[model samples]
Target: MGRRARARRQQQQQQQQRGEEDGGRAGGRRGAGWDGGYPEIVKENKLFEHYYQELGIVPDGEWDQFMGALREPLPATLRITGYKSHAKEILHCLKNKYFKELEDLEVDGQKVDVPQPLSWYPEELAWHTNLSRKILRKSPQLEKFHQFLVSETESGNISRQEAVSMIPPLLLNAHPHHKILDMCAAPGSKTTQLIEMLHADMTVPFPEGFVIANDVDNKRCYLLVHQAKRLGSPCIMVVNHDASCIPRLCIDVDGRKETLFYDRILCDVPCSGDGTMRKNIDVWKKWSTLNSLQLHGLQLRIATRGAEQLVPGGRMVYSTCSLNPIEDEAVIAALLEKSEGALELVDVSSELPGLRWMPGLSHWKVMTKDGQWFAEWGDVPHSRHTQIRPTMFPPSDPEKLRAMHLERCLRILPHHQNTGGFFVAVFVKKAAMPWNRRAPKPQGGTGEPRTCVQPSPAEPTAAPQEATGPSEPDPEPGMPDAGVSASPESAESDGARRDGVCGPPPSKKMKVFGFKEDPFVFIPEDDPLFPPIQKFYALDPSFPRMNLLTRTTEGKKRQLYMVSKELRNVLLNNSEKMKVINTGIKVWCRNNSGEEFDCAFRLAQEGIYTLYPFINSRIINVSIEDVKVLLTQENPFFRKLSSETHRQAKEMRGQTRYAAPSCCVAGGGRRPCGPSCPRTNDCTTCA
Candidate 1:
């Protein structure tokens, strides 16, 4: 409060501004500082500028302040109706503060005992280990500062909206045994969320659910794999294919059609991504009303594909982070138009936990291609274009299909709720179509029987495959075993099995062959080259071809080219202080080190070499080009180790510690709150 102190503070602020302009930027984009550029175009766009103003934020000054305004205190209570036993665990976490007397709350006009907020005592909120997660507590607001902390914690501050979008997994009402699909999933948050939902809590082991998280981009498909493992979910399968082509009628060995219907499906499809303004400011720079107008076609295509895969009365939540009506209401409207009343939007405001929202527009007018409201409103004078005018609601008639009723669709407004805008519409297929109504006939012109059509990966099938059971072997020798060996060489050699791994070896039988006989395979406690893993094999005999690429790297310089469930687990579960030496892996290098390149550069292989920069651990797949570049690229590091030592060093660094520095940091950071001269001050190394 002294004059000298205030003057010093002001001087420091000015210097900080100069440093920012002079390139003292530190850390990767995720660090708690500027991502170091002008506020993203998306953040500065005309529309987004207004959004910031509505939130009482000054757009130009502080970007984080603009974002923090979007955060609101989440409701403390989550109602669980059917699963009382499961509800108890949720209640237990909230028992102490707001609902200590669980019995006082009445549901359906009857008194029910609800669990209360649990205590929030933990040494730390640990990650990357199999150790059980401590239940976070519900502490009361004690002081002015303490109230802020509690508010931040309860507002889901532990997660970003990108992470929050994936919470659908935690809200599962379906059985864990059901099969699920994340249609149009990429940059995969929702897919990972589903994995978390189906996966057992810390108290349970090996959850009974399964998921096939697929994406059209072969590159993005691998991301689904990484996210699945990071979230600690084993009950998931990542497929690199289009969603619309998911096969419909896969037949088992018994000649029975594969009825792979899913109890739950997530259609978190592609959109304009307007809701990501806080994180992806680039979108704002290129923001256009036209882009959203075009995405409506793809969004509908992906959603309809998801619906075709849902079991009767099964739940599929269609969602997008974009606030544009075209990506939300219009797409849902189109799907309902095509379903012939077979698919009905399910009310989700009452179904989900955390927050409530207003339903989607039941009736909406589409703007004409010429840029005027089309229906009864007709043409507008050119002079009127500059003026903002609201269109009148169209008159009802017995003729055209009524505006697809979407009272079930829900929208989240950033201004109204102080949260990123989002739209969600949950749809359920009706119990049964009228018996008198017959499906359309196939293209031939005769009095012939109709045939069952198989669904494509993009079409969304409704059947969930169970682990196959043993039966009479096929008349053809060895037709019974599938996925017995994952190596390409072995699949090629086994004439007995349809899928084979081929190598030059003349006398290689099978490595393992009891898949149908036994779904569970055990590994010894002390296995060297391979770590222990729980593999869930798909049992649908007629499903699309699923294969794995596994091999040992051979060269004068020895290396390993294998990616497995076991190795992924090891990196995800261990953390000790370690140093990161970059390996040219693209995913690990995003927004890093000044060099940027498209990951799609290599197509000859299915994977890449990943060096755990921290531990020197190496992972191999289709190509190690990126990892090689990352490791060899010049930085401040000096290479003093032997070639062999270098290989080992690179492999060790490929572990999780090298991947997620934020999660691995202790007490978060070493530097003091204010600036000090690293040249003069004693800098504590991260190690």
Candidate 2:
């Protein structure tokens, strides 16, 4: 047999062996790497023919190669989240242990190296496996590698999904102080990345910057919470909001109601996802030209909202998984035209080194499936069909179009990076967007409260106990995600009016967060309760005493929580501007009488890292042996602490009872409590 035929036989035979030996077993079809059943037989739809024909114009000779590459599954890729406690250590283990097992692995007689990190990714945190996941699981030598993925992902040490999905976060270049917004964050792979970057400086308990992760679908926000909880960053606030009409929020800073804005925004809008043909093999059959046509307005509106919310000089990344120019360059072109020089496509040529990419198309045409060609917007069928915007068409003046510089946008073809096709366009807000003069504020909107959607907190399931079982639901960037929203056909119809222009209605009135009174009411500085706990923990009086608040929720919020002054400003100032879903961290808690300390406020485990440096007393170190015992205890109390711990606890006695400090070993260093930490070791507890 020839090389191709022999390779096919080898692949099939190995698959058969795997099915027999481990098919229904640990790493099988119903396994961690397996994304549901085998990929469906997807074929091109006729409706998408003209769409491809138009894409062919700018791509020139590369069109055939691009289309052919999407036929196969994308290589699995994941990035270790930054600002995580065990990030570097986990990366070390992967390189040495898990990846080492794949050193001698081969599939279809093709030698496959262990998962390799992205050359452009800093610190080698992002990794890519050259082969599709199916082949990887079938290979005998790579079994342990597969098991590693299942385990590590469940433990939140790794995220497994698609390669191209990792691009937008890298482009955002989040910092420790930049307040960020994820407009359509769901199954929050990128949201988690942004959270990590927000805390990348490793500042604990709080970040000067915060991430407001929002999704249109209220149900999918649960998935987003699941993803966000893994990072353990207290700075994230998940909300449900429609991207296009997300309400404006304001903070009263210096007696001015400053509009709540983000230093960076990620608008990974909903798309038809034709570029996802690799893993979502069904896209081939489901592909339709109308998918982009219907979604163009939504994408345009979402990106525009993102721009409006962005600070001047702030950057917003507009991305889509579809390869269609209508969804990619066309929407960007629309936003630029409407921005009136306030938005510019940023050239990120040097951003991700060693990344193979093509520039965005400067020229393309719009064609209907009916073989009708629109030479220009004027030629579009206004009466026969809905009017299409000028931005949807490549401008008649080539110079003007070239000046738009859409080429700065990055396009990742599957063959170029062994990844799925993706389009990413970065725009910097050069100046405040000139609001349309025709747009009017909602009636009764002045100084009146609007409706609100209040959702109960989303409690995520505990981390996976074993790695080699059903694949955890922790989807990284890439692959089909949870339900994003309604379908495209209905989306267009719901979004359009008699003119067929799509625009979701804004809030009928200004949003009021149902605040008759401030919740973060300040406790007097000299309150009787402050001396015992304050003296014991040695808290700085300089810390904003007013930002601390007590709440009734005892589960996760505990009894006492502290919001950073910056974050508190946003929360208080924007009470009428938008719906604030969830915010703040459990910095301190009121302990029951049974706890080790009678003090009402013991430093919460999540907030300890950030608060520890500020605290002056009530800290005791124990041996590693004691640490293990504290972590493993069941009664939520560490009764076996050394003399150092007992003496420290006695200093802050108040309604005292022993309780879990949640202190557990992390990075072989004394770290904050984890979920697995029973909060038993109260030694680190600031009572």
Candidate 3:
């Protein structure tokens, strides 16, 4: 019998022996029968144990400890938003207020350990707590702390994420000037981290960088939108697309069209998620070797596409939550071989000082679900050839295997650090891919004279022509091409071609799926809506007027949003090529009562930080006590304020706006308001 079958038989024998011992000790009591009311123990999975045992992934004499750690529940972890100016204040509150109260508290006869900072995470912004979610909800001693977490999470001041999931973004090392992309970003916790890294300086209201977060599921794209909205960043754009075939977008640079390449890419592909078994109990029953086998192709495709779009010398991190070598080292080896020296694995052992991890495996065996093992591709039977591919095996040449440096990949295990298992491999692009190294023909009469036409907002732009370099070698029979076409030609083609230089022949474009969003309409520079607001606020001349846009085409615009100059270039050029789910930050909201104040648009809380620097006049500075009263009581009379503050408020004749420091209003759910006359019809409008 194979190893798996024998292991299962042995497990059954042990269970039977234990049952007999228990029955004899009970003296055949009626309540102790086999069918008695009792919950079944669910911690065992013979096949899971057997599969790992064969691989020998656990160190000598540590297998029992490894299995023990997987059976325990995962602890709760949270991260404070580091880019915000009030992040220090929130951390202070967590340490001094909440941690101090829980010092001597015990729940359900268990002592609760004080939460500690994740040493690897910078600035002590992240914490690890022994208390699980169930205890946090039911324990009266932690009630106030629980409320604090809920409030801060809702306000986007903090995030609760798995500790290991936060590693990829930090390893990405994003900067304010780099263009980043998050492939398969859904329920976006890591995407928010990328946003925080881009805004690390905090003083720059609008950064040059932007993040394009893409997910295959249409519904999950909204989750990304919700997360980005909480951070209130203008540089984030959520799009819906299959990461394996995400389109090549073009941008206008110096009046010339150029393909857009990212400086950093996060390819966190989907896997069997055996590492998450601690928190997601269902994985214990659902995991199988077949899952990694099926997902190998899709994962490689996504990583390859990300590499193709990365600029030379740029970095891309490929990560998964599975410990299976078939999904981790095997995939990285295949990608390295395909790159042909254009990509290399980066050694990041010293990046995270306190992180505990093992080097990636250089050797592993492949097994079928039926307990059939394959030492090499030649060992597979002809009937099973279709199920297994050569790329799934390690390189046969020992020297070539050593040269690839597969050991540079980091494998994080749960037993080492009370966290989920994760595999991360950072790659740096040395040159263009073999197939994409063709020299471009110069524009303007290099070939036949062709008219350059701009596509309308309603029409899709023509797809770019496939580049032709030296013929590439054929891949294995079942292996897919690394550079897959983003949009394929429709079957019913009319045989029309827009000049050969423009793109492919006329064909039906890929159909955009999901809810159709409102078109982004930029207001005219001379629009009638700008003069009054500009004069009232004394706006600076350097303010970008064309970047302000409304969602509606022709109506009383309810909300006006703003995007950075770099993002505006992308939106204007590639609106037809990409499926943008949401972008822009709300900067102005229409208030009907504001007509009496000579301006109909009022400041929005979501974007006050972005607009605060451009306003040259009509500013009010209030003290901390005044801010407390404004937050506690809605629309208090000016007479209640201190003398100096009352005089400043009375000097403003029309409707007034209030701006508070970030620390004072970080998690406070109150909205500040101006003093209003009792006889007025609107409470927000000043007399």
Q: After superposition, how far is residue 684 of candidate 3 from its true place, in Å?
A: 8.1
Candidate 1 vs candidate 2, lDDT winner = 2
lDDT of 2 by residue, 1-687 (tens): 899999999999998987878866777665656686665475666666556665563256766676677775567788776566668887898888777777886677877767778887788888887656677678765676677666667646678657778889889988889989999998889987887787766534567888888887766877887777655566777766667767655555556434566899999999999888878877877776667777777777778778877888899999988888889988888778777888899999998889888888877767664556665687776673463556687767777677899889898877776778799999987775665212333425453222212111221212222111111121111112232233455445433422211112223331342212213333446656566666556677765666665542123334555666676666544332334444555566665642455355555555555565556545455566656665555443445666655554454342133443322222123454343243422425222
lDDT of 3 by residue, 1-687 (tens): 999999999999999887677778864434354466654448777888888898877787988889999999887899999988778889999999999988998888988899999989998999989887777877776888998888788767889999999999999999999999999999899999999998898778789999999998889999989888878788988988778767666667778545678999999999999999888888888778888887877788788888888888899999999999889998899888888888999999999999988899888888887777897889988998657777778989898899899989998888998898899999999987776654343334253212112333243322222211112222221122233222323211212321111122222433334546667777777789888778766788988877788877657888889988888877765655567788878877787866655677776666756776677655555666755665556556656656766665556543454231101111112222211112122222111
lDDT of each: 0.40, 0.65, 0.75
Q: How many clashes in each candidate? A: 85, 17, 0
Using lDDT as the measure, which candidate wins? 3
Sorting all predicted structures by TM-score, with the top scorer first, yields 3, 2, 1
Candidate number achieving the greatest TM-score relative to the actual structure: 3
Q: For candidate 3, what is the lDDT? A: 0.75
* Model 3 pairs in collision: none
Q: TM-score for all predictions?
A: 0.46, 0.72, 0.82
**Model 3 misplaced stretches (Cα beyond 4 Å):** 1-41, 138-140, 439-512, 634-637, 654-687
Worst 10 residues of 2 by lDDT: 468-477
Q: Say which prediction, candidate 1 or candidate 3, comes out ahead on TM-score.
A: 3
Give the per-residue lDDT of model 1 (tens digit) for 143-175: 322343244223222211232363354343545
Question: lDDT of model 3 at residue 402?
Answer: 95
Estimate candidate 2's RMSD in Å: 13.9
